[model samples]
Target: MRTALSMTLSSFGANRVDFASRIHEALSRVQRGDIDVVLSDLSLSHPFDGLRLLEELKTRNLLKQSAVFMIVTAEANAQTVLSAAELAPDDYLLKPFSGETLRQRLVKAVAKKQAFKVVDQAILQHDYLRALAECNARIEERDPYVIDFMRLKARLSLLTGAFLEARQTYEQVLRIRPAPWARMGLGKSLFRLKDYPNARRVFESVLAENPYAMEAYDGLAGCLEAQEDLLSAQEVLSRAAARSPAIIQRQRQLGELAQRNADWPVAVDAFRNTIEYARYSFQHDAGDYAQLSQSLLASGETQSAEQTLAQVRRAFHTPQSDLLAHVMEYGIASARGDAVRAGKSLQAAREQFAELKDNLPGTYSVALAEACYRAGDEQAGKEVVSSLLRNQHDDVAVLRKVEQMFVAVGRESEGKALIEDHANDVVELNNAAVRMAQAGDLEGAVHHFLSALAERPGSMPVALNAISAVLAYVGQHGWHDAYMQLAQDLLARVGAQDPTNGKYQKMMQAYRMVRQQFGIKGA
Candidate 1:
């Protein structure tokens, strides 16, 4: 394929063509020089494939608007094809194509890339509204890539939180042609709007047409889970995992679902796969070890559970991991009726938690709370759960997990009451700030949220509200350097927490607008 591509490019009077047989070599070459075109095969010998290469290029911001990326792959499987398409390659060429065919495809792909240059620029700047407008204008021009622009418009609408517009755009595209991507986009829009039944139907329809559509399976599973059909969701995810076991998020989702269903063996296997698949990926986490150990203990495998904790201690030599290891040890010891060992493990865990509580990830709180309760430290347990609730007041999933933890410890009613209390507190605090802002007290509102953030340091809602208030102040009162810095810092924290969050993306767009309005050089 490489030889053919080189010959084709040479035939087209291209001055230079570079080739790399491995993912690392390709990445290194791209990093070291300016490359105008990249043609990669779907199946690479390394665990990282062509899709991963494309991902790395985007992550490193190496793929310029003028440069084209085309996938040259013989693999015709739906999983590979859809995955490649999702990354939005310039074009995909199947094997056994002629030199002339390659030239034609390359020319067309380059033209498309050139046409979308402005739209790409807007997107890279996090200006989705501008990009959406560009896409809309292009669609009105009846260009050759009208469908592509329509697709982009739908995607940008989703990013901008215009779910109804996204749904409408996707449906319009589907009316023209039943593209799988369009169908998936429509399902996503419906999901965002909380129309789970219709979303489930759309995803199911996609799977019926293309059984290997892994994303369709995921969407269907999510809809099922949203409708509280855990068994069906588990079944759907299990089928998807059987077909493609390399996706870490899918494996992790399956593990959590199975754990929720009390299918400890399935949870163990899924989490084991998640750990293995994520070993070299950024998705790897110490929480996976904790989850695997919990599943193992639930399945009456205390020795294996202990071994997993030991692995966590070795793999991650951080305070958080040490705390996690000790917490798991306490569980294992308690399970084996070793009261003395359990007490010692609990004491060590408490020491580590004392040092790390202010900045701990909320994921570890449940286990720590459970351990505290088992050790007869009800005050400590309540404190941990309360802090978690304060930080994650609006996260339904985390709240559900907290409720489950409470149920496991036989304090379900207390959990419910505590959750309600914390939720109300956060809501009332947020409302007070909103009222202050509405009463022409933007500065007061900003200060209010900042104080709330001090009390709930890891609270995403609080941080986002603080950012909003700060930006509003800056927008109305001119750019206050301190206020702008506060907004940026809060944004950084929110991005570190979850970059894909729609609210974070919106705040980023707003921040950029503010900077641009003020002639800020660094925006």
Candidate 2:
């Protein structure tokens, strides 16, 4: 009852009009700061309609603990109600409704928002652990909309790498309502846990509900990709892109699929669109320019390819930016039928890399090897690849690159033999570590992992799992200080190298648990 009075007072203090003006200003302010509520007329202008506004807000962010967004419509109908419900506004009211409905909605919204206030703030600040804790606290609150609360918390858990907690919340949400998002969340958790079949099943269920759900399609494609089903992954990306042409990410996904299959033209087009969309947003990436240049060269548009390379070299002046610049310049020189110039340029690149002196992994060596081979120095190219293999002996991608370099230099048999030797070494070393782990000699297993890493520091799987096993063993040791030190080191290494490695993430989660249990700093 006093809300109108409070609104009037607040409006005077803030130099606003009436309650409606205050609400409008508040809703507009949502983008600037975290809005706790929204009040708008359902029947507004084209893009300013209440439903459209709510949809935009939902897509930008889900609900926060203290976010109490509502819709006030002129008239309620099946269509309007369904739309509002689908967006899951905190409260919905028919226009010409009494103050009672507004008050009721406000009170309910405020209560729900307060319940989630801590979590919302934490998540907004990217403190996912706090969000998960808050959500877990409200998992069984006596509210009809607790399911939404639980789902929100589960999402935070997933972001925080609390996969087990996220999986539990997802299951709970599914039991209450088979929401497509919840199903997708479960699939995502299963994927994180490496349960591909279950993840595929969950993604399929999401598709059954909404066949054009791009997220589900992407997730399904990821499942296929993990299983090495490139054809199926390509098909999935193709279908998703066809279904949602407006999704720039889907286009980029298709581009990646095309590039993986060596479809240069498709890759170029898709990456071009991706770069276009990225120019104005947070998705912008310098690598896109380099990739576009590579694709252009692959398509035999040598002049256009050189132009693309020039753009990247001129536009980005950072240290690592020169890597792609050098790579593309070498390619362009070789394409122009000037092996002599190409050789000189590649030699300069090699000298530059040597001056840097192992600051990065053997990436420069591999790239340079390819350039030298293309420039007709077959023996020099072979030596370059051999040096790289010596540094990163167990990295499959690096090994593949080396093999390609050898084949380009007319040394296919040498390349095959080299790869086979490394493969045999990896298999034996990995098998020994596995046996050590199974035999409960975790300390010995950890030593083996360290040794394997010394042998091939760039092997993502071997290095990541090695760190994971160490963290897991540390968790069992009750050595909180040692655990924290090792955990932070692993996190730094992962951040430096393969940040996307799932096992590295598992170690991160284990680290978090140890930190939480021991009340360690940076938890």
Candidate 3:
């Protein structure tokens, strides 16, 4: 293969090397931007291939505008073409081609890369409009990059939230050629438009033609899940996992789906594989370890569950993981019919939980609630569940999970009634506070909100209201040190509990306004 490539490059008066064989050496040079025009086979000897190398290079910000990648392969099967298309190769050169053929292909590939350099530069600079315009100009000029740039314009449309335009471009591309990339883009655009049925069929067709297209599987899974087809969605992810087991997220999803199906054995296996494969990647999560322990206990392997919990404790030594290990212990003991140990674990965890000056994250709170319920400590469990409900009342997924946990512990009736009563208690407190503020009694409003916070310490809505009520009271009545401190602490909980919320950024600005008026430190 190298000899063939050498003969081709020599006749074209171009330098070449076998990047497939000397992958590490080539990648090292490529990383330093010392290599260009990578002519490579479909696959390399090692796990990382030419396609993967290009992916890694892009990840490292090394794939510059000058890079020209042309797939030189003897085999251009559906799988190969689909994989190559994903990387957006400049061109493909099949075997049995003469030196002149190789020269022509390389020239065309380089020219395409160079012509699209303006668009690439614009994209890198985050100028989607300019990139789209350049693509449009090329298409109008009938350039060789007509199809590629058309797809680029579609992708930019998708990125810029022009889903209808992207759908139109993808449809046009499909008419030109029955291509997987166009079909996948069509599925995505349709998914964005909330046309789940059409998107599902489009993705299914793509997968039918190329089963190795992971993106198609993901899109199809999304479509199924959007339509509430959990069983079929799980089947799709299961198929994807069979094809590629090393994806931690897919394994985790499969584990979650198996759990939803009450398939404990499959859940256990999926989570176990998640743990094993996660060791080789940077995407490892303590949740997978905790979940594996839960699955093991569910499968009646108490000893193995304990050992896995211990392993995670050693693996992650953070305060969060420390809390997680105790949560796992409670679940394990409860499952093994050791209520005494389970209760002891929850008691210890509660003490540690309360020792923190912040509210629990939703994920941590859910784990604790499950453990507390299993240990027959419904009081602590109720408090944790209340925290979650108060923090995210609008989240259907959270509501469903809360019900599932209660059902699992045989407390469905009690859980439903408790959530409703506690929810009403907080809502009444918040509503009264809002009423007081409306009537111009900021003092009374602040008091009511504080009372609500006392009941549901994780309530962001109440916390934000209390902060506002206090700010208004102070604006009229002058600053009280304790009131200011309360406002700051409430803001802190907003960060500790759910910093990912879009509200966090906006609320931070409000917090800063108060801080500046009082000449205090940052929020």
lDDT of 3 by residue, 289-371 (tens): 88788787778888999899889987888777778788898888877788788877777778777754244555566778887
- Select the stronger candidate by lDDT from 2 and 3: 3
Candidate 1 structure lDDT: 0.82
lDDT tens readout by residue for model 1, 186-262: 99999989999999999898888777666788889999988989989999999988877767788899999998899
| Root-mean-square deviation (CA) per prediction | 3.6, 8.3, 8.6
Backbone clashes for every candidate come to: 0, 3, 0
How do these models rank on lDDT, best leading? 1, 3, 2
Q: Which prediction has more favorable TM-score, 2 or 3?
A: 3
Clashing pairs in 3: none
Tens digits of per-residue lDDT for model 2, 465-492: 6777777677677664664566577577
| RMSD over all Cα atoms, model 1 | 3.6
Query: Model 1 reaches what TM-score against the true structure?
Result: 0.86
Give the best candidate by TM-score: 1
Task: Quote each prediction's TM-score.
Answer: 0.86, 0.62, 0.62
Model 1 poorest 10 in a row by lDDT? 78-87
After TM-score superposition, the amount by which residue 481's alpha carbon in candidate 1 deviates from its true location, in angstroms, is 3.3
